[model samples]
Target: MTEPESEGMVAQESLRHTYLQAIGVQSWLPRGALPHAAPSAPWVETFTWPPTQRFEQWEDAFEDTSEVPAAEQPVLPVTPSVNAPRGVSRALESLQGMFAPEGTPSQKVLESTPPALSETTPSASALDMSYQPEPVAPLQNPLAERYPEPQFSLVLMTLGELLIVDSLPPQGRQSFSPAHIRFVSALARSLGVQGYDINPIHHHWPAFVGSALNQGPDEALRSVRRLLGNMLKSQEIKRVLLLGEASAQWILEQPEPLDSLRGLRFSLRAGVAAVSSHSVTALLRIPELKAELWADLQPLLATRT
Candidate 1:
C-alpha cells in the first residue's frame, strides 16, 4: 500500500481503539510500537494500600464547634389579609371560624344566620298529613311477564353428517306436511343423501305439562341447547340447516329476519357449521322464496357435491 493509504488505515484503527477505551473496554496493543501507529502511554496503577493522603479523624472534624452558630428557628408563612380576593378571604375566614371559640363574633354570626331555602320548597304549614303520595304499582315478574309463554315446535332431522332443523306447523304437530316431506326428500337426494338415511327428532318448547315450572325463553333456550348438544355428541354432525325463523331463534339464538341470515354460515357450539333459510311451509306458501332458498342452499349443495 502507498504511504497515505497506510497512514489513513492506521488513523482509522487508532480512532476505533479510542472509542473502545472510552466505553471501558481494555484494548490490546502491540508490546512494541507499530510501524505507523503513535507510541502508547505507559500504564500506571491508580490505587495503593494505606491511601497516600491522610483522612482527618471523625473526632477532630467535629471538635471545631465554636465557629458554628446554633440553628435559628424556622419562620412560618404570614396569613392572607381581608384585602385579598373574596375567595381567598372567605377560605381564610372559614379556617379561622373552624378554630375560633364558641363566643367569637364569627360563631355568633353563624348561629344567627338562617339556612337559605329553595323557591320551590313548600312551607312547613303546607306539608300536612292529609297530603299522600300515589301508591306505587307492584313490580311484576320481569322474566315470566316480560316474555310471552314461548310456544314453538321444531323437527331436527339428520342425514349422514348434516343436521336439518325446521319449524313444524302449530297445533302440536310432530310431523311435517306431505309437501314438506317431498321437499326434504328432494333436498336430501340433491345432497346425495338417501330418504331412508334421514332420521326425524321432534323438539317442542315448554315441554312441561303445567305452568309450575319456569318455561321462559331463557329456560327454553337452555333446553334446546342441551338437546342440540346431546345430538351433536351422539352423532358425527358436521353441518346444520336451520329452516324458518323459529328454528333459527331457538337453535342459533339469532332472532334476525331470515332474509338477512339466509345466505350466511354460522359456527355452532361444537364447531358445527349452520345456515338458516325460509321454512318449507313458507316455500310452499310463497313459491318466490324458493329461488332465494335455492340461492342460500347453493353453498351447502356445493360442499355436499
Candidate 2:
C-alpha cells in the first residue's frame, strides 16, 4: 500500500477510538503503535474490584457491636395477663375501700357488678310487644300530574307559497271533514291555486300515546315550530294562514283571544307572514264568522292574486 494511504488509515482508526472513549465505551487498541501512525497517549489499566484489606475492614464494621450500649438494645414485647398490673390493682383496691362498707371485701364488690354486655343476649321481654310500622301512602305518578294527557292535533296544508294551519276537534274525528275540505277548496280557487299544488301535513303532540314524554304546552309549541320549519324548507311558503285559537297558540305561541288576533298580520320565523282567523268548524257552525274570516284574508288575497 502507499505510505500516505497507510497513514490516513491509522489516523481514521485513532479518531474512531477517541470517539468511542468520549461516549464512555471501552475500545480495544493495538499494544504497539501502528507504522506511520502519530505517537498516542499511553493507555492506563483501571481496576474496579476493591483490595482484600477493604473487604476485611467492611467485615469489622458490621461485626463490631461493642460501641452500642445494652440500654439501647430492642426488647421483645411481653404478652398481657388476665390480672391487672400491680399499680392498677392497688388503685382499684383504694377506690373499693372508699366506696364499699367497712367490712365488705373486693370479691363481694366484683360479684355484685353487672354482667358484661358481650355475655348477655336480648330476651323476648326486652323488645316492645306492640311495635307497629307507620302506614305508607301509595305512590302517585308525577308525570301524570305534571303533564296531563295532551289533547292537541293539527293539520297543515300548503298551496303554492301560501301555507294553511288548522286544529282538529279534540273529542271527535282527527281529519278534515267534507264541509271543511270544500271550504279550503273554495279558498284555494279564489287565490287562483290549482288542486295539484295543495299538500297537507298532520302534526300531533306527545307523538306516542300513554308515553312518559313531556306533552305540556311548551313541548307542543316546540314540536309545532319544528314541524313548520321542516315544511318551510320543502316549499317556498311566503304566507301562513292560522285557523282556530289552538292553531295561533301552537304556531305563534300567542295567548291572546281569537277575536283580538283576527285581521292582524304577524311575522313568523324566516320572515313568513301569518294571519289568524276562525276555523272551518267554527265557520260551518256559525255562518256569521265566514265574513269575519274573509275580512282577515283580504291582505293575503291581494298579495296572491
Candidate 3:
C-alpha cells in the first residue's frame, strides 16, 4: 500500500484498540469468534438465580449490595498476638514493616502498634476484607509468539517450494488467486498442525508477493530478500514449505527456459530441509501423504469447488 494508506490503517487500528482499552473490554473481542455487536431480540437471553441460591455467605450479600458506600465500609478491629508459627509471625512482621512508616520504633510506639499475628484459622473479619480490583494484568500481547514480527530474522529451516500453473492466455493472474492459497494450505496440512489454512496464506506468502505486485520487481525482490534474510537471521521459522511449482518458480525468478520448478536452481539453507511436493491433484489421488502432513496440508490448500 501507499504510505498514506498504510498510515491510515495504523491510525484506525490505534483508535480501535485505544477505545477498547478505555472501555475496559477484553482485547480478544476483536480477535475472537464472538460477534462484535449486541445480540438481536430473538438472540438476547438472560436469567438470574434466587438470592439464597446465588450467595452462600454474608460477604457475598455485602458484595451484591452495591448500595453500601465505600466510606461506610467499617474497619474491623482485629485482635492481635495470637500464637502463630515462627514462619507466619515472621511473614506478618515483614508485611507490617513494608506497610508501616519508616524508622526504628520506640518501645512505647511498638507497644501501640498491633502485634504481628494471624489467627490459626482466618477470622470472619479477615476473610471478609475486600480489596479494590486491580487493573487487568497489563493486557498480554495478543500476537506474541504466535506470529513472526515483520522484521527480518533469518533461521535455519525446512523450506518447500510451490509453483502455480498459470491460467490460459485469456486469464492472466494478478495477486494470489485461489490456486496459491490452496497450495499453501495443502502443504501445511501435509504436516499435522490442525488449524485453518486461512492464516499463513494471508500473512506469509503475501508479505513477499504483495510487495512485488504493488511496487514492481526491484521493490518486490527487496522484500523477498529481506524476508529470507530475516527468516535465517532470527530463527523465527523452522520448516520451509513451498506451495506450487509456479509460485516456486516466481520466487526463483526464472525469466525463461524453465518448464517446471524441478529444474530451478533453489538452494536450501544449511540445517533447514525443503520438501517440494506435487499439486492437490497429484496428492488428492493418493489417500495419504508419504506422511500425514502432506495429506493434511494439501486439503487446507485446496479451494472449495
Candidate 4:
C-alpha cells in the first residue's frame, strides 16, 4: 500500500479504539493501541448501546473475537489485557463491579453516596442545624428559703449515710431494718410527716451515708454535717426527737445509756434539746412524744399544701 493508504489504516484503528471506549469496552482492545489517546467527546462518555451509524462505520476495523468468548468465559475476568484503554477499561470494569453480584447478597442494593445539592435547593454544605439544639429548663428549688429558719434544738448522732427528700423537718435512720421500716412508716403516718408510706430506704441517713463515708473521715463528716445543716435550716425545726440512742450517740459521739431517763435529753442549746429514745418502738409507747412531734408537724403539712 502507498504511504497515504498506510496512514489511513492507522487513523481507522485509532477511531476503532475510540469507539470501544464509547461503549465502555476499552479493555477489549490491544495494549498501547491508541498511543496518543485524548479525552473522548461527551456523547462517547455516556454512550452504552453503540449507535447504529457509528457501529456500521467501524464494522470492518473492529477486532475479530468470534472464537474467544465460549471456552474461556470464566477466565475472561482474570485476563484484563483483552479490555480496551487503561483509563476507560478501568472505568468500565468499575461500572461492572457496581452491578457485580455478591454471594446471596445480590438482591440487596449496594451502598451509595448521599445526593448532592443543586441550584434550586440550599447547599447541604451550609447546614446550621447544630446551633438549633433543644433548650434546657432551669433547675428548680422546692424549699424556697422564704422564712426565718428555726434552729435544731438538739441533734442525735448515728453512723449512716444521708440523702435528701423534700423540705420540712428532716430525719434519718440507721441502715435498713424491717423494724426500722415499720417504725418510720407508722411515725410518718402518726406525725403526718411529708412522705410516702412505702419502705423507707433512700429518704434517710443509713441508706445514703455509707456511699459518702466511703471516701474518708473528712469527706464523711463534711457530707454528714452538710446533711444535718440542711435539716437545721428548716423553719419547722424546733427539736429533733432522736429515735434511738444509736442516732443520739451519732450526733453527740458518746454512746449514752439507752434506757436511762437522765440520758434521754441532751442539751444542744438553751432552747434546743436532743433527746434519745430506744427506737421508734419507744416513741410508740411514749404518749407525750407522739403529741409533741405531732404538734411540731401540723404547720408543715399546711405549708406544703
Q: Give the TM-score of candidate 3.
A: 0.27
lDDT of 2 by residue, 237-263 (tens): 888889987787667766666888887
Model 4 over residues 91-199: C-alpha lDDT tens digits?
A: 4344443434443232222443346667788777777767776786642322113211211112222211111121112343224446545655554444344354343
Report the lDDT tens digits of candidate 1 across residue range 6-106: 54444344345434533557665455667888765332122111212211221121132335443332222224443333343344344444434444456
Predicted candidate 3 versus true structure: per-residue lDDT over 208-288, tens digit per residue: 434444443343345555655655575433344443443333334433322343322344465443333343433444646
- Off by more than 4 A, model 1: 1-148, 172-174, 269-271
Candidate with the greatest lDDT versus the true structure: 1
What is the C-alpha local distance difference test score of candidate 3? 0.37
lDDT of 1 at 145: 39
| Model 1 quality (TM-score) | 0.49
All models: lDDT? 0.65, 0.64, 0.37, 0.40
lDDT of 2 at 182: 79
Please identify which of the two predictions, 3 or 4, would achieve the higher lDDT against the true structure. 4
Kindly report which residue stretches of model 4 are placed more than 4 angstroms away from their true locations once superposed.
1-219, 255-263, 281-305
- Model 2 residue 59 lDDT score: 24
